[model samples]
Each structure stands twice: as C-alpha cells, then as structure tokens.
Target: MATMNRQHHLRGVLLASVACILWGISGVAASSLFMLNPHITALWLTQVRMISAGMILLVFGQFAGVKPFAIWRQRATALRVVSYGLLGLVPVQLCYFEAVKFGNAPIATIIQYLGPFIISIYFLLFKHVTPTRPEALGMIMAFFGTLLIVTHGHLNSLAISPVVLFWGGLSAIGVATNTLLPRPLLPKFGAVSVTGWGLLVAGICLNVFGPVWQDHVTLTGAELALILVIIILGTVIPFLMFAHALGYILPTTASLLDAFEPLAATVFSVAFLNVQLTNYDLFGGMLIILAVMALSLNGRKMINFLRSFRTE
Candidate 1:
C-alpha cells in the first residue's frame, strides 16, 4: 500500500510538472507566432485556438463516453455554459493572448498568478470570509512582486508599458473568473464536457465580431506547425494531464507544482524567443511564484471557500 501510494504521488507530480511546462511552452509558442507575424492579432489567435481545441476536445469527450451535448439538457446549465464561455473562458483566452502580444509570456504568466489574490479579495468583500494568516501574507507578497515587475523596483519609472500592465491585470481577473465559475459544472458534466463546450461557445461568440476564416494573415509552414503545437501540446494535452493528475495527488501538491508554469515560461521565453530579462524581472517572478506556493499551502481552505459560492 505504501509503495503504491508513493507511486501515485510521483505520478501526480510528474503529470503536474509536465502540464505546467507544456503550458509555459505554449505561451512561448504564441509569443513566437506574434514575433513571426506582426500582423497576427491576439483576437485571431484566440479564436482559432478556442475553436480548434474545442472541437478536438468535444470529439475526445464523445469517445470517452462523456455525452458532451447532455450539458444542454437544462436551460440553467445551458445558460451557465454560455456564461462560463463568454465571461470565464473567453476573457482568459483573449486577454492572456493580448498580454503575451503586448509583453512576453513570462510577464503575462507571472501577472496571471495574481488570480489567487483576486479570489482572496473576492472572499473578503463578498463572502465575508477573512483570509487566514498565510493567505494574507501571500497576498502581500504577490502585490509587492507585481509592483516590482511593473516598476522594476523603481517607482519613478515603468519597466513595461502601461498597455501591457492593463491587459495583464485583466488577464489575471480572467484567470480568477475562469477558476471560480467552473466549479459547479465539473463534477456533473466532467471537465472534458464543460471545458470543450465552453471553448466552443466562446469561439462561436467571438466569431460574431470577426470570423477567423476572414482573417488575411499569411502563415508559413513553420508558423502553421507552431499553431498546431499551441493547440495540441500547449492547450489540450496539458489541460488533460493536469486535470487527471488532480485525481492522484492532493490539490495543494498539484497547485504547488503549477508554479513550474512561470519558470517554464521564463526559461522558454529566454531560450527560444531570445527575450531578455533583468534581475528585477527574475526576482519579481520569484516572489510571485513564492506567493503562489504560499497560497497553495492554504489550498484546502480556499477550495472550501470557493465551494461556498456554488449553487445548491
């Protein structure tokens, strides 16, 4: 029993780490595409990503006996699906891409780490739940970390443009909303069904603004391959792996391992994209990751608090 438990723990860690690494790499892949085609907009990339990944995951859900369309049986659930898609998933996808476009992936990813802090604040304001000591400390760390990144440790000047900061801040809200909104649906419909449908709905909605097929950006063979990698390796596989790993390990453990995402993003951005980072960037990023780690220590309380928001 002990050996089997140990094996499951190790498997969980590996799955979580690889999922985070792939997520980080996917951001770099998006950054590479942005660099390759200055004409490529984050809106277009997000639409394509949501549409393609949604369809693929829906197909996978069917094969897995998940009954993807069953989520639409009830009006409430159907509406929730649409809301989750539009308000939760779409913003995260679109804003994240925009952040990456304006800044590098590392900056975007680290900023998105503010999601937990946002959640904590929500609990305080709305739920009347006070954050535990660890949660409070983590929030302070995240604030200072983000401050360092924006100011480069100097309040007089900004390191990144205000535009990047704006989108990145919105992206963090998107992350928090996405994390919060999907809790009720996952158990009933399964992550595969909820996520797949949510993506498709968001994609369809985005299409009303501008269809991807109408976009006129020319793609080389290499860029096409990178898009495929972003869709498959970056989005779909990592999501599946991370979700599955949750079954084998504690949520706290999985959340801690997710810190690898920023590290992977920074490494890949520097190594592949040749993006430069200063000491302030590295140190700020470190603090943000540490904040995430601290929050992960309070994962159980956070989960319970989030669950309080779920409808009966």
Candidate 2:
C-alpha cells in the first residue's frame, strides 16, 4: 500500500509538472497570437478559446462514462460551477493572456508566478498556517526577486509597463483563486468534468458580451492553428492534469511546482520572442527559481520555521 501510494504520488507530481510545462509554453502561443494580429483582443481570443475547449472537454468526456452535464442537474453543483467559472476561469485565463499581450512572454510569465507567494500569505494570515524555514525564505526570496525584476533593482523606472504589472498581478491572484475555488467541486465530479463545466460557464459569460459569430476573424490559417494550440494544449489539457493532481497532492504543492511555467516561458520568450535579458534580470530570475525549488521540495519545514517566528 505504501509503494502504491508512492507511485500515485510520483504520478501526481508528473501530471502536475506536465500541466505547468504546458502552461509555461502557452505564453509562446499567446505571444504568437498577439503578433498574428494587433487587432485581435485577448478578450475575443479568450472567449473563442474557452467556448471551443469547453465543448471539446464536455463532448470527449462522454466516451469515458463521465456525464458532462451532470453538474447542471444539481442546483448547488450548478451554482458552484457557475461561480468557479466566472470567478476562477475568467480571471486566470483572461488576465494571463492580457499580460502576455501587454508585456512579453517572459515578463508576464515571471510576474504571474507571484501566485505561490500570495497563497503563502493568505494561508499564514487567514488560515493561520505555518511554513518551514525553507518555504518562508523561499517566499521572501520570491517577493524580493519579483520586485527586483519589476523595478530592475531600482524604483525609478519599472522594467515592464505599469499596465503589464497590473495585469500580471491580477493574473497571480487569478491563479490563487483558480486553485482555491475548485476544491469543493473536484471531489464531487472529478477534474475533467468540473473543469469542463467551469470553462463552459466562463465561455457563456465571455460570449455574452463579445460578438462571437458576427466578428470577422482576420487571423490567417496559421494563426487559427496556433489559437487551437492555446485552446487545447494550454487551456484544456493542463487544467485537466492539474485538477487530477489536486486529488493526489495539496494545491499549495502544485502551485509551488508551477514555478516551471516561468522558466519554460523564459526559454521560449528568449528563443522565439527575441526577449533579451540583462544581468539584473538573470539575477532576479535565479532568485525566483531557487526560492521556488526550495519551497516545492520541502515547504513544510519552512512553514514550521515561519510559525516559530509568529509564536515568538
């Protein structure tokens, strides 16, 4: 039983890793979308992506004996799904793409990584949770690292635009809420179904305001194909994997592992987006990476250390 549990744990980690990896590379696709058409708003793109991917997940799950519309049958479940959709799905996806739109992929990716730090603070204050030394230090490092990146080690001029900063911060909050909102629903309907329903709700909300069918798409075939990648690989697949991960591990742990998204986004940003880095940027990035690695590996110890300070 122990070995089986270990195997499940390892598998969960792998799934979470894959999810984050896909999310990391998603910046590349989003970056390409902005380049595809300066006129294509993230709003419209997101609406389309959500609606399509939601449909796909709902349809596909039927083959696996999963009743996609089962949530709609229950008033409470339906309400939760709607809430998760409007609150969770929209913010995380929309703000991320908007950040990527305003800033380059690397900047958007790194800034959004503030999710874990935000989570830590929330737990410490609201949940009265304690982090070990490693996690506490890691959170501190991540905070300063993010500040360094944004301010470029100086407060005079931010490295990215103010708008990017706003969107990025919102994206981080969205990530936190995204991870938190689905906990109740996951145990009831499983990952894919909950995600599908949430996405569907988000899609309905988004499309309610945007003219989906009437809007003329100026995207070339190649751009549409890239958007498809954003819809399927980035949105659908990763959410499913991460949702599955919640069953096996804590959401905080999954969020910790999500540091890879920034790294992966950085690589693609440099290689494809031609985003150049400076020494300060590299230093700051290293700080964030090291902190994430530390916390993810042994967060409980750090949480405990943090608790000691509060006690003293």
Candidate 3:
C-alpha cells in the first residue's frame, strides 16, 4: 500500500511538473512564431488555437464518456457555458497572446500571475471577505512586482510599451474570470465538459470576428510545425495532464508546481529567443512567483487568519 501510494505521489509530481514546463515552453513557442513571422497576428493564432484545441477536447471527452454535449441540454447551463467561452476563455487567450506578442513570454506569464491577487480582490469586494495578513502581503508583493516590471522602479520611464502593459492587465482580468466564472458549472458539468464547450464557443465567436481561413499569412513548414506545437503540446496536452494529475495529488501541490511555468518561460525566452532581462524584471518575477507560492502553500493558514480578523 505504502509503495503504491508513493508511486502515485511521484507520478503526480512528474505529471504536474511536465505539464507546467510544457505550458511555459509553449509561451516561448508563441513568441517564436511572432518573431519569425510578422504576418501572423495574435488574433489569428488565438482563433486557430482555440478552435483546434477545443474540437480535440470535445472529441476526447466524448470517447472518455464525459457526455460533453450534455451541458447544452439545459438552457441555463448552455448560456453559462457560452458566457464562459466568450468572457473567460476568449479574453484570457487573446489578451495573453497579445501580451506575449508585445512583450516577451517571461514578462507576460509573470504578469498573468497577478490573476490570483485579482481573485482575492474580487472576493473582498463582492463576497465581503477579508484577506489574511499573508494574503494581503501577497497582493502588495504582486503590486510592487508589476510596478517594477512596467516602470523599473522609476515611474517616469516605462520599461515596456503601454500596449504590453494594457494587454497584460487585461490578461490578468481574463485569468480571474477564467478561474471564477467556471466554478458553479464545474460541479454539475465536470471540468472537461465545461472547458471543452467554453473553448469551442470562444473559438466560434473569435472566428466570427476574424475567420482563421481568411488569415492571409503564408506559413513555412517550420512555422506550421510550431503552430501544431502550440495547439497540441502547449495547450491541449498540458491541460489534460494537469487535470489527470489532480486524481493522484492535492490541488495545492499542483498549484505550487505551477511556479515552474513562469520559470520555464523565462529560461526558454532567454536561451532560445535571446531575450534579455533586467534586474527589475528578474526581481519582479521572483516576487510574483513567491506570492503565488505563499498563497498556495499557506491557504489554510490564511483562511484561519481571515477568520481571526473577522472575530476581532
């Protein structure tokens, strides 16, 4: 029993780590696509990615007996699913891709880390929940990290363009919506079902705006191969692997392992893309990642502290 448990634990860790690493590498891959081909717009890439991954997930869900389309049987659930796709999935991918296009993968991914702090703010404002000291401190750290990333300690000069900053901020909001908007539906519909539908719906909406077939960019064989990498290795595979790993490990453990994502992006950006990072970028990235780790590892303690604050 003990050996089996240990094996499961190890498997979970490996799966989570690999998934996150692949996700991080995918960001760099997207960056590469942009650098190699200026004609390839983020809008076009996002549409292709969402449609391709969305279709695959739905098909896989069918084979796995998930009854993927059953969520559409009810009008309310269907509406909610559509909302998730439009407001959650679409913006998250679109804004993040834009951020990566304007900025490097490392900065984009690190900035998206602000999503959790945004979630905390949502809870505080809407649910009237008070944050623990650690949670509050994490938010503060995230703020300074973002400040450094954009301003580099000097507010007068912008280290990155305003476009990147805008997209990064939107990406964080998208992340918050992506995380929170699907919660009520997940219990009844399952993550795969909700996400699959959400992606498909978002894909369709994006296509309506700019159809993938109409994308005028000509692609080389290598560029096409990288596109496949983004669709398969970066998006679908990691998503599935992370979901599966949850069966064997705690969610908190998986969340902590998510730290590898930004790390991988930073390494790959520097190594392959020849992107240079300043001290501000490095320090800001560290603080953001540390804030995520602190929040995840000390979630229960943070909750306890919140309760104590309420009592006081």
Winner by TM-score between candidate 3 and candidate 1: 1
Each model's lDDT:
0.90, 0.80, 0.87
- Model 3 global lDDT (CA atoms, 0 to 1): 0.87
lDDT of 1 by residue, 1-312 (tens): 999999999999999999999999989999999999998999999999998999999999999999999999999899988889998888787898899999999999999878878878887898888888988888888888888999987899999989889888888888888988878888899998999999999988998888888999899999999999999999899989998999899888988987888899999899888899998899998988998899888878777766666755
Candidate 3 off by > 4 Å: 301-312
TM-score of each: 0.98, 0.86, 0.94
lDDT of 2 by residue, 79-108 (tens): 878888888888888898899998878788
Clash count in backbone of candidate 3: 0
- Candidate 2 vs 3: which has more lDDT: 3
- CA-RMSD of model 2: 4.6
lDDT per residue, candidate 3, 228-280, as tens digits? 99999998999999888988998778878989999999999999899999999
Error (Å) of candidate 3 at residue 13 is 1.8
Query: Which stretch of 10 consecutive residues in model 2 shows the poorest summed lDDT?
Result: 303-312
- lDDT of candidate 3 at residue 121, scale 0 to 100: 86
